[model samples]
Target chain A: MTTARAGALLDRLGRVGQFLWSGWAGLAGLALFAALWQAGHERYGDFILPAPLATLAAGLTIAADPAAWELAGQTTLRAVEGFALAAAAGAAGGLAAGYSAATMRLARPILTVLLGVPPIAWIVLAMIWFGSTDGTIITTVLVAATPVVFVGVAEGAVTRDRGLDDMARAFGAGPLARLTTLGLRHVAAFLFPALTVALGSAFKVAVMAELLANTGGIGGALAAARANLDVAEALAWVLIAVAGLIAVEYTLVHPIRSEFERWRNAARPWGVKR
Target chain B: MTRETTDAAPSLTLSGIGHAYLGRTVLDAVDLTLAAGEVAALVGPSGCGKSTLAHIAAGVVEPSRGRVARRYRRHGMVFQDPRLLPWATARANIAYPLRLLGLPRRERRERAEQAAQRVALDRADLDKFPIELSGGMRQRTAIARALAIDPDFVYFDEPFTALDVALKRRMQDLVIEAARGARFGALFITHDLMEAVRIAHRVVVMDAHGRGIAGTRAVPGKPGGRDDGTVYRLVAGFLSDDPLFRHIHDIDERRTP
Candidate 1:
């Protein structure tokens, strides 16, 4: 038992080392993107597009202030709250639709209508309903993020292995046991990727709604920069928003997803390693 | 005079079992019984509804008409494919049914390891995922999973049909040995007469149209006791001369219900 436990620990450590090592490739990709940004800045001039280094300096200056931190934190909190609600509602709805044919048929047309309406349109509607507050930003984020998660989870549920279900039944598993053990585990593969997409949109829509609703967040800071024609400061706020997204995606979403998908890594060839 | 014969009771009884998929009838008026500690190899032609019958008997499919009575304490099953959970490690896959039964984690682990050892699966291979294991090892893990439940009866639905010749023989030997040691009754379903003659105490052939059981032939000796020459001769003789096995080799995939 001790040896088995040790082996599992070692396996986990190896995967963690591999994950950290893969950051080099991520950094290289980022550097390439920076090179493209620099080329754009040099061509357009500072007034049109600030240089990457100048933006970083401005972002650092903003980061030094305690008030700027609150602005960033307020936006993060709104986006994360909306994302949590979306995940819960979408998963429940998707699981319902996936297991029942009648529910799936009904949900499809409604989902189509939901996806067909633009996030901007919903933001306008939410602004009218909830006014210029956190409510407006959160409502817009929920509308934008829920459909992505719902579609992914529903598809996951629909395509589950019937053979496995039969195998489970033959072993005397009841419906509830089958659902918890097999159905949920199968759906998780589809859930994580949908969550990543939904999360990305959650942050994007939160920022957009904050700007339109005139709530005091990074969006409000951006509005101030726009009023004074401070292009570098606006770019710096955008940089900070993107940095928050990266931090949350890496620290929260990616780690949990990797833990669930470690078996997939074992299937990969040794030479490919990724 | 009344006699107490609890030991002589059948492990399973299926009476007038019938099934249909959509509107198409796949099985009709089928009845089968398995006595305690008897390994019955059910053989039939392709598309003969043999698998459907197995599924119905195992309660994986609800029969359109009939009754199924299982007297065994608990049961386990192995399918044609390994059916090991791809996202789980081999050890976890073996322990899956135990988890379903709500066994404590420690006992689950111990039983899973013991089952693995019964199938001669290497201890190190238990940690690997289904994708990491070879075809033979994966099937072995599946068999181990079935054994882990400590079942009094088992259902094997063409469990070794996917393996190569040598691997198939090895798996058959493993099942034979396992059945001998565990003394569990089993309903072994396969289309191969040679396999049926090799592993089963009695070989049952189903009707071509799945109307009913065509006939049954008792093998001369216990499974794992018969020599290769005896098994080969019996299969050949049945194929060439036995009227009951005339259509056992027939294949029509389009006719499968």
Candidate 2:
């Protein structure tokens, strides 16, 4: 009955509409990518690169098998677990580094070393340590992805809006409250980008580690397909891993990230007409 | 000469307040005082360190060379920017200080709504994020947040410099109305002489380079209900007669994009 209630409902609806509209844009962009893939297929032919439609058929056929589903599930679980652990450790380490100068000085060199070392090297070490198990895959993913997240979050903390911090201090906000409200939120800006990179790396490292360690996952399936010299099956497994990564990104990571970033869409250029 | 001390804390007192950046002096020997329930406006040109003084007076910045005293249970600061957390709703932003005070969720929400009402922010606007609200609305949210804690003192550091003429006056009225019976003192910083004359009990002028006070003009009667003509006349007298108010207009002109 009240206008305020009505306005609130309208604003919520408007936000939902904006979200779906952006989703459509994302789909449209994917369609363009599919079109490019189809062009590549036409040039390279079926042996080198399958047609987009043919690849879709192959992926569907592979998905119909329950064993393939189990393999896909294993790979997804490894990637997600590794990402979760890395996120926790990296965010904690980065916040410490950001909040304290001594930590930053100590961490900067170590992070640089970790980041500079290749994932292949880590996967090789994990294979020697854990010996052909999920441990090898998860360890490789964590080592590969943690520094990426740590660097992003640390930079975000360092560059947080000091003006906002002053405003908070004036309002009698204690140290902990300020860290949660202003400090963490500022880091959220950088957190999402780092997560995107970490997510991709998690999947890549998981698969690479699995293939090296001969653990059971999509990577194993790809190795089997390669041994059989079956181009379609190998491509199908690759497509399945990518789809899984994308699903987790959309369903898990993105919704939370969008909540924090909704404010960014509202900052418009001055003097620009609506 | 104004190295003042009091056994009991007054609203605010600063003497011989000076600041410098990397051996370059930005302010020197600036003295100011505000009584409880009184509002004093510090008017100066841009870069004159009026803001720096407001910061020192509010204890946000330690004066490089001065003794400062503040006797207030709680202090509020309204920055030039609203500085609302973009991720937070207006209600959340307004309730932020109360949350710091460790009030319950329901009580904080209630106080936030009450403060929003004081600033004439409708319930609908309270639910909007700072970005969704207009610039004036954001500033009002900032004001509401500042007043929600019921502070004994407020430092308004050029908080109304960004509003349109109509919005600016409305906000000024909200401020004066809020301060009327609250008994909270305020240090209002501005480069606008008319604005200072309209809202402040007294206006302290800081000249360029911020070395010392150029002049202090006491506004007759209370802050509100003074005729626009009277305020205008007083402002005109300052511009021509006081060297400090002369460049007040120049600061206004140079920064008017």
| Best prediction by lDDT | 1
Residues A1-274 of candidate 2: C-alpha lDDT, one tens digit per residue:
3786797689778766766667877888889999999899889888888887888899999999998899988998998899999999999998898888899999999988888888889988988999888889999999988998999998988888888888887776668888988899889889998999999999988988888788989889888888898888888888888888788787777777766776665565543311
lDDT tens digits, residues B1-257, model 2? 12122233567778898998777777899877667667888887788788888877776676789988876778899999999987889999999989888899989999999999999899877767788898999999999999999998899999989888999999998888888868788889988778898998888888766888887777776788788889888878877876556666554423322
Report the Cα lDDT for candidate 2.
0.84
RMSD of model 2, in Å?
Answer: 4.7
Residue B222 shift from truth in candidate 2, angstroms: 1.5
Off by over 4 Å in 1: B1-7
- The candidate 2 chain B region of ten consecutive residues with least summed lDDT is B1-10
Model 1 lDDT per residue over B1-257, tens place:
11122257888888998888888888899888777888999999888899999998888999999999999999899999999889999999999999999999999999999999999999989889999999999999999999999988889999999999999999999999999999998999999889998998888889888888888887888899999999999999998988888888876857744
Report the Cα lDDT for residue A100, model 1.
97
Clashes (candidate 1): 0
Question: What local lDDT score does residue A271 receive in model 1, on the 0 to 100 scale?
Answer: 75
Provide the lowest-lDDT 10-residue window in model 1 chain A: A265-274
The predictions' CA RMSDs to the true structure, in order, are 2.6, 4.7
Docking class of 2: medium
lDDT of 2 at B33: 68
